[model samples]
Target: MARRGGDDRTLDLLAWQPPEPQRYAEERVRTATLRDRISRAVSETLKDCEQTRADVARAMGEWLGEDVSENMLNAYASQGREEHTIPYLRLLALVQVTGDTRLLQLGAELFDTTVIENRLKPFIEIGMRFDRRNRAVAIAQEEDREIDVAIRTIRKGARQ
Candidate 1:
């Protein structure tokens, strides 16, 4: 039998063959591209609809009993729920008219940070007392320390 070299030429030639480029299947690429476009379109449509809804809500609030600017009204109306419930809409309007981002942010933060709930407890109590059904007494009560603190903070920041 003929002796063969440890590194065989024939084996090296076979191993040297170039690998074929991986081809993405046409159907998968097309489907993914189409899905992405549809998702983008839906997002844009929702944004536009939200802006329009906010404009309408702000207009309605102005017609009610507040000298609410469009910007403030829009901000309040933008917070509305899709369910279109009257009470929820009213709450958004109240929040906007009051320009109380502190309360809004505090409410959201309370759910995330337990310590914030403690800081917010007094304010929440005052707010509950003042809700639509009990506005008269809520308003008549002595000045709210917690609310005063919040308003002062807002004013201080605005001046800066």
Candidate 2:
């Protein structure tokens, strides 16, 4: 479609049709479960981290005030060891040691909640405030319509 300025290369958003919702649901089912994904995530974080597994274990142990061994880390990273999923507190310690906050975000996504970074809090707050203001405006408009209807009913009765 040509733009107002006569450029023929611009795409028109008004012509776009959204994909069917079933497509999205099927895609979700195609993905791995949360348990397997978390195992992969732990392995990936360990692989990408600058610290050695033992060093991470030691740091995590110190953070948790409990013994977190290399074997425990190994089990957490292994997909076959489903029975050995890491506990929440130990996961937090691991996150602290490796600085991989995405591990925390993975769980939050399942609940349809966001894990906001401290730096982005102000920006998110502004968006939330706008959402609240828009809802308030919609509610006020609805109340105004009801008030107008009631006033018209009373005025009509008085005239009769």
Candidate 3:
């Protein structure tokens, strides 16, 4: 309340209760479907080049010196089976051909990293520290506001 005497206008620190922990399902991250993540990345990479799945398949097939089929590409881009996920080599080829990193980004996200690239440069970081830091600050500010509201409520209750 105060250093030593009667004018003790403390925050009534003990009167404040900490908020309850949030439930798992109520946490920030949502459970995303792998199928959707894969399909969206593939489609966005192709779409940026004004290319269809067939065109990408043909180009990638030529680059890989193997038969990457249009139907297989379609299946991969159309949310096919779990085993239908594109390999890393194919992903690199797609990034090379389309010159976009949407798929690469999804791969980075899966491994808890971020992807940064350009025509002559590429960079991958170990962890998503920046994002986590920003989120932590946001949560702290929110909690501060909640505590302010709580203190006001207690002061009001005491007055009445």
Candidate 4:
């Protein structure tokens, strides 16, 4: 077989072998349609609670200090994932105001219950278990326990 000019590879090696074009096109269309439907639903839901949304936006801007957009607000509302807890709490407050039960349930479901109970709670408990005065062996033991639990959870999750 003749090698291609660029890297001396055969055409069979260099040529793209994408999925069947018609199937790919159909998948793309389906994804686009689903996205459109979800967007419309969110838009309609937001419109029904425009005043609450505006309040949430204003509160988030005030809390985040003028660097937020409606899109950011929307993401915060739709998905509670955030680098900081401030946006999550603010979004929750807004949802409370709006009486949006669905968003509330979604947020509750998305909240990382396992991490909160297993990781954060244990860390805090260990911190509190050690006295400020005698902070040598007890602190070390607590820290070790926290680390062990964390490692075990990580291993378990990996296995699963």
Candidate 5:
């Protein structure tokens, strides 16, 4: 038998409905929204140290020498707020106040990127090899997990 390949029309015809695809699409959009992700990251970072909005606001005000109220900070973390993006300086302050990089990491992960400190841009290429090494280590970790899972399954089957 020979198979013929067609374009968009064929794909459209062959696509499966699989019940409520629209619902899945809507949910994906809801969850993947950048604003929502940032807000969630802020909330998670706060939760780690058992801090409240007021605590953050007070700490930030003291650290930055500005008056930031609890309501303003709460609005930033809450959904559908105008301040979807936190200022870079404020974000730095958040890192200092919270003592956690989760918020910055979350924003970077959401965009499939990373934040690395660089003192001199001209000398920054020297760090590429180190970054590649880190990537290799990550791949090795994933391989180790796969091997562990395989061994566990094999032992379970032998017992059965």
Candidate 6:
């Protein structure tokens, strides 16, 4: 294929094939509200933690340089206390203290996104590049089809 007048040589997009889809752990379809999810995450993380609620709160307070009382933590984790939502920074501190990244993953899932370790980001980037390449090839083929149709019409007009 001839190179375009750009820095990179044009690829033969027509010959390109898309990569196979990858499957990860499938999450069950949930009907819970965000508020419920947040409350559940806080409760679950606390239950799994070795530290007491007071200790977790103290660590969170220290991490944020603010007063995070055990009562406040309880309120944040209480499903009935819809108004007592955990602040973003407080949630971050809680995750840091408990090392429960699912708290962040819950939020990411709301936007159809996933939370992954830093080490795996390059592999995700590779998949993204493949998606981009597939889109480019599709667009190029469409443009080529339009050009061919136009050329055919002009040739028929000249023959008449």
Superposition TM-score, candidate 1 onto the true structure = 0.18
Number of colliding residue pairs in each model: 0, 0, 0, 0, 0, 0
Considering TM-score, which of the candidate structures 2 and 6 is the better prediction for this target?
Answer: 2
lDDT of each: 0.44, 0.80, 0.66, 0.49, 0.66, 0.82
Give me the candidate number with maximum lDDT. Answer: 6
Better of 5 and 6 by lDDT: 6
Q: Report the alpha-carbon TM-score of model 6 versus the true structure.
A: 0.70
By summed lDDT, which 10 consecutive residues of candidate 2 come out lowest? 20-29
Better of 4 and 6 by lDDT: 6
TM-score of 5: 0.48
Candidate 5 lDDT trough over 10 residues, lowest sum: 20-29
Return the TM-score for each candidate structure.
0.18, 0.72, 0.49, 0.27, 0.48, 0.70
Tell me which residue pairs clash in candidate 6. none
lDDT (Cα, tens digit) per residue for candidate 4, span 43-116: 44466675766675776567656655566557642423333223446545454555444443333433642212
Tens-place lDDT digits, model 6, residues 54-144: 9999999999998999999999988889999899999999989988887887788768887777767787899899999999999999999
Clashing pairs in 4: none
- Any runs in candidate 6 off by more than 4 Å, and if so which? 1-33
Cα displacement (angstroms), candidate 1, residue 95, comes to 7.8
TM-score ranking, high to low = 2, 6, 3, 5, 4, 1
lDDT of 5 by residue, 33-132 (tens): 7777666655555556567768987998899998877777666666677565566677777888887765665556557775554434434575687788
| lDDT tens per residue, model 1, 139-160 | 6553576688889999999999
* Residue 143 error, candidate 5, Å: 34
Task: Give the residue spans of candidate 1 off by over 4 A.
Answer: 1-54, 60-64, 73-91, 94-106, 113-160
Which pairs of residues have clashing backbones in candidate 5? none
Better of 1 and 6 by lDDT: 6
Ranking by lDDT: 6, 2, 3, 5, 4, 1
